[model samples]
Target: MENDRGTKRSRWRDDDEERQTAERRRQEKERKRKQKQERKEKKQQQLDQNKPDDNGTSEPKETSADVNGLDLDINGLLQFKAPEIRSCRGVNNYEMLNHIEEGSYGVVYRGKNIDTDEIVALKKLKADKNQYGFPITSLREINTLMALQHPNIVNMKEIVVGGSLDQIYIVMEFVEHDLKSLMTDMREPFLQSEIKTLLHQLLSATVLMHENHVIHRDLKSSNLLMNNRGQIKIADFGLARFFSEPSQAMTQLVVTLWYRAPELLLGAKYYSTEIDLWSVGCIFAELITNKPLFEGRSEIDQISKIFDLLGYPDEQNWPGFKSLPHGKTINKPKNYVKTQSLRTKFPMMTSAGIDLLSSLLQLDPKRRMSASEALKHPYFKEDPRLQPPEMFPTFPSKAGQERRRRASPSAPVARHGDHLNDNKNENDDDDDDGFIMAAPEDEKFGLFREQDKKGGGFQLRF
Candidate 1:
């Protein structure tokens, strides 16, 4: 019995030794695995430090050029992957189509959505040179467009960035035709009813912009786009800015030359939304006459033209006009004080229309009409009544097709592919100074029925 018990004890001791050996071996293997993982993680962290951050920015690191044409250093070829020209389709589900046109700011292209198949206008902003980073103008446009949402305001679809740090693309709702394009295609000047429709839309859009504290520094006809549905939407916000207070100083070098306000021309350091109203007035005149109201050759010529028509500004008309930066330099006409008259320029315009125009074109910035006030102007309520947007005609789908059919071969025809040119000549763009006289006086009518001189005013209907 004693021998059997001793054997059992020896067997139990051997089993215990084997269990201890296995545990130590398991612990040794785990320690080795952890050490290997630590080394791998350290290497990964070093690599991540060299790569660009989430915002597409990276810390400046020392770079040394090697004979292989690769930057060799701690932040070397391994740091930044070569800029790959990848299709935006796999990246953001947008397939770029043909190039539309390039502007001073960016190149615009027609794009399609792979998911929805919706057409979009893709504007690729020009990247700034090294160290400057993303353009502030691009940032401003993106921030502004994202905040504004209205039927009349052009819609920004989404932003798509290329694999390369340099490429930035803004996706916007595609607009078929701009007013400039439409005007070129029209057989005759827009009719009075159509003018009312266009003005109403312009005023409505302006009201929305002003309400949002946004100032469209550039409000040219080319920036106003109209779809086939006759819905006009304001576009091109590269020059736009948000204003918090009226007293805030804004750059006078804003609007395009011809549409620039008198105060801006006089180098007023402080201005308000009145500057936009001035552009609106200019646009209104252009729409009615089918030509620029004041087509000046230069900045100096522009101010001179305004003075020639409206008479030289004085304290009597514009308080503190001479206090402006350029006011002192502008030479006044010798012994010539001209009386301002809209009648002479627009003889066929209705009285209400003239009144609204004068108010919008007021020499004093304070006297200029506000967008909301302009919408409520008696001119809009007067005859002929403002036409519905749906009634407005659409431009030809194929460029110059309608114009060619309407205009004789002898009549100057815009070239077949002229619209495709991205770099449009400024001189050619603004050449629509062809004055279109207002409709004949006999053809005009009032919106309301004329009251019998002796009879009670026309009864109101429910």
Candidate 2:
């Protein structure tokens, strides 16, 4: 009887243990399932917040990452390494008709994408093995141009890589002439009204570029180009790049020595958008005076030229001037005469213009105006020529991207205007700005590109 009782107790214990094991497993599964659900919700939230929005119906959406706030960690975002940017779009059958422009970078030839029945400019930049630095200037240009599409900026039609003898060919919109050419051929002196119009166009362009987190390190007369219709477009972004994070410190030289800001000229290691604004200021002075604002021959000559025009900047005026990389040991002019006067150069310019110019040409880069801030200044606010913001197109298509090109056979025929060619010829080697057209001087100026070309220049509002 005792043996039977013990056997019953043992059976009961075994059943209890089995039941406990089953309960533990059920609890564990429930916990795991809840945790997975929470994780999935979190992932979806992140994706929804970070993905770029395609908001504009009239245009395409922005790609890559927009770092307007610089909130994301840069290291985590550096996903794209050097890529083999090869395109399969062959150009063998395409016939090269006219040689467009040749420079230190490469040769540009106007050609028809026979397959697409579209006219395109083919830029061939072959990097020599000896040219150790900036071998991928073309690559940098592509990366910069990819994100921008303002009427003031150049547009890349397509990229042809690993084609035609291992060379890279960039097919871009074919513009007739550049601003430098147009200005040279105008023959008449630039009118004050024309200056305001040009400045408005340039300010609008730079503002868009800054919004996109790009610096056109080079901004000068040569870089601006024009089309047959006389619309202004900014071009040449070989040194341009997207700023995924806040601009960091660097010792690299940028911008042309002439338009280079006093800080860059002083060899300050770090820089930001201010550098571009300074160049804009110099270009503004150039347009008004019909001469370069600071014509520095060498690095030192350039610095001297700036001081001669602006003034001798001391640590008291420019607190950070002394610590700059190039500021330590420099040749000071025999007599340090500070000239903070713009009226002397442009007596006809308004007080508003003088104020904007001084702000942009400040010796301290930190004090330099921003592209955004500059846009709201009194110059643009008081601009007598500005129309509605909606009228301003973003890029090479001052004609409007939505505005279709005419379909007539005459539309296909390309004619190079003398005034446009003259503008382009002036800057055969402009380092700062590229071949861009002038801003519309009058409504009727664009009627005939050759005879009555636009009459505006980018005024310095930055």
Candidate 3:
């Protein structure tokens, strides 16, 4: 009984000691927290006392000295300051006038700046559910537009945001008409001088782009915008990117099917600015003929149409033709002729113009005419002097008043495995006896609207 009582007493004593130890630890923790609070209060008080008053008068705070023991004004010594970050304005600042058109990357709207009353094109970027964050194509378009600033290139005024995170809009200078719509509405084809003027402006913009090491992978008639003053502005930089020396392997699935280059159609992975020049060539032909130069439905048909116009490209013309990824897959047409029919196609075009066109549409990318070279071509210097922009006739802007009814095909969305397929019609490969003529007259021409005939056009004042 005595042993049990002694053991109980010892247990009690141990429990009492543990409680005392815990109590002491709690007290120490409380003391440290209180001390931290006091120090924070003291520092805050010192800062308050040192801070300048509303009148800009205060006791001079002690300045720390550098390693040389010389007092320095930190603000004066530090010449660099953080750049002020300005948030984008809300989209509500602009009143939505009408929906212009939806493109592959964004939905464009005709808007008016409420403050300045200036009309602007507001392009709200499309959200991709499959994407995790901002689309890379949209990001490239923004970055490219910001980097390139030229008169003939679309001007990005500012960026505006809507209510949500994905609701971003790009504010740009509003252009009156797109070339494709204008050509569709025209009663007759453009005059030679007018065509020359338009091509000159396009070449100028392309020169600027190429000089900056940028390649506009997509260049179609619908992508070119024209104002009332006849100024041309290249739009849609979703496929544009900076190219470096020793060309890199880029996607072959760029540029629309109608304007894709022959090499690209043949699956040339490492291409440069020549692909854009080929598209420009297609646009040039479209401007002359009042229709798309190569209106093929599929990749095979497109290449066949190209072959029908420019003849089959062999090792003599396009070196390393057999080495391309999809080059061997193309079966040469048995009945195909080996002669270019550009002269027969455009009989009315001057020899200089034909030469320029041929250079641009060369089967070999190495032989393709560059934008700078095309700008100085003799076609512009030939008879019928280039029509000045102001002299060019104005047209009714369907974009401002109403939505476009007959829009051209949107740019091809970037995807994989869209190359030439084996399931295409075998007849397209076998039947290549004659050149494919221009689109039928009725299909190419449209009745001129009353407003267009009356010379009534709209123009933004500011």
Give all TM-scores, in the order shown: 0.67, 0.64, 0.71
C-alpha displacement of 124 in model 2, angstroms?
1.0
Regions of model 3 farther than 4 Å from truth: 1-83, 338-340, 402-462
lDDT-wise, the better of 1 and 3 is 3
List the global CA lDDT of all models: 0.76, 0.68, 0.83
C-alpha lDDT of candidate 2 relative to the true structure: 0.68
Best by lDDT: 3
The residue ranges of model 1 lying beyond 4 angstroms of the native Cα positions read 1-92, 337-340, 398-462
* lDDT by residue for model 2 (1-462), tens: 236556435678779999999999999999999878876765565666566667623432333344343333233243434657664576674667777677667778878777777777788876777666435777778887888888877788776654445477888887766666555544344444455667767888999888888888889877877665435678887777666455777545878888887787776756778888988888787766566777777988888777777778777768867787777675566866666567776665668889999998888877888777777778766634444433322323321223434445432212343222435566456542334444354422222232333333332211
Q: What clash count goes with each model?
A: 1, 33, 0
Provide C-alpha RMSD values for all models, in order. Answer: 18.9, 14.9, 18.1
